[model samples]
Target: MDNVSSVIEFTLSGFDEILDYKLTFFCLTLLCYCVIIMVNVVVVVTIAMDRNLYEPMYIFICNLCINGLFGTAGFYPKFLLDLLSHHWGISYTGCLLQGLVIYTSVCSDICFLAVMAYDRLMAICRPLEHSSVMTRQRVAQLVCFSWLAPLGLLSASTIFTSRLKLCGSNIKKLYCANWMVAKLSCAATNWVTSTTPGNVIAYVIILFYIFLGVFIFCSYVQLTRCCFKSLANRGKFMKTCVPHLLALFNISIASLFDAMYMRYGSSDFPQSFQNLLALEIIIGPPLFNPLIYGLTLSQIRNQVLHKYLQNK
Candidate 1:
């Protein structure tokens, strides 16, 4: 309890064991961040500039890339600095802000994917009604919902977490997360008591993800049924839905790995493996989303290539 009042910063110990290879890791991380920015920027610019690509699907994808940039910007710069510094510490306010940014970006990502799934569902299962349902105004509304819902949810969670009286100044991971900050609250205090604010917020987040998972699952099931009914539907599924599905799966697995590891990870595991798991969510999806969509979506790929040839 004595330690609670003086704790103004958290020491991130995740990098302690990696000092031997810090320079190597720093270069790789910088390169990866650069590539993430460049690739996502290209996709976003290409889509935004080409009026022909201004459909509901491309709009959703452009939003996804923007989110990738938003999320990684919250992490990579700080991470690169940490790799170069002797000590890894973050002020309390900065920690909360980072958690807010990263968590909201992630939640927005899943929300976008779910909305994209619904978009595909309408396209395939209700083709005749697709245009009527997914009008530009409607797409704009959905996009706003995707960004706002997560922002509001995570903002509440972060606010609740900030109210907690933390008793420790050590975070195990390289980055600040809401759960990590919540874990630092004094166990004997009112804030961490049974049904405390932190617990309630955590439960809300879990429930939200559960609801999202169920919604996406049901949407995909219906989409699968619809696609199986006709050759034309199958082609539509392969053409647009496949890339979304692939991106969804990639992010899902990455996020799940990080979540499961955070909840149940053992100290017996190698630190490198632990670090890799911690990094998967940030690295895997941001890098993969653009590449997957760029390669698979013919319109995007052709536009990118045509632009490249024109410059060449």
Candidate 2:
């Protein structure tokens, strides 16, 4: 195939062809990106600088914020330019790097969230041991591993992707994504087909062990028991857990569905649904993840508020 074919570059049929929302989309996306960066920066910096946020959970939050910031950093500039110029022209290396950043960040994001869940489980289930178990050393190790795993995956995948020869004009969807980039290849679709399964299986296994089998089940059981024991002060526990639970649920659903869509329904899906799904998967979680940590989290909120008040 390589001998027979010349390398092909993709021609993205711009979103303006069907929807003339380029300028509008550019403004909206820029605003959203700005908010995402600002909020996440404040949250991460506050956690790092604040004396009260020196604990394991806050450290996890810091990692989460950092992942999000980097993840958005990878996509927003290119996306913003595409939106403004309505030019979806991207080189092979640039597209590959975008995919690398996205996959790396996404893989790290999910892994870190799972780690955070485990941390929370320890805190709730074994409060006495939580301090020792979720130490700074351990949290740092987890963050390192989270980052390294994705980089490894991306490296392996990129090797295979780089070998594929492209033919004809590259056809792309509204966004720049790995699978979309891969589809433009004249070579076999095996990479695209295989990528989702490997990632989903890895995450699902982690989910099974950490979330389904242990954290979710055990934590809820203990949390329930605690709530029942504190009948008069039920609201206290609820207030603490509500935001984290919601955040996890949101991330899980969005991530899981994204994986599923990529694996099973890529070609069969409607363009509009595909567009919306991609947007939701990309932008929605980043927009909300910080809110889940910053606004709902008492320590983060308190620090932010205190800083704001002092500045005022």
What is the alpha-carbon RMSD of candidate 1 to the true structure?
A: 2.1
lDDT of each residue in 14-72, candidate 2, tens digit only = 35344566777778888999999998889889988988778877787788788888888
- TM-score of structure candidate 2: 0.82
Q: Return the top candidate by TM-score.
A: 1
For model 1, the stretches where C-alpha displacement exceeds 4 angstroms are 1-6, 188-195
lDDT string for model 1 (180-245, tens) is 887777763454563276577778878988898899999999999988899999999999988988
Model 1 poorest 10 in a row by lDDT: 187-196
lDDT of each: 0.88, 0.68
Off by over 4 Å in 2: 1-8, 17-19, 187-240, 260-270
TM-scores, all candidates, are: 0.95, 0.82
Please report how far candidate 2 places residue 304 from its true position, in Å. Answer: 1.2
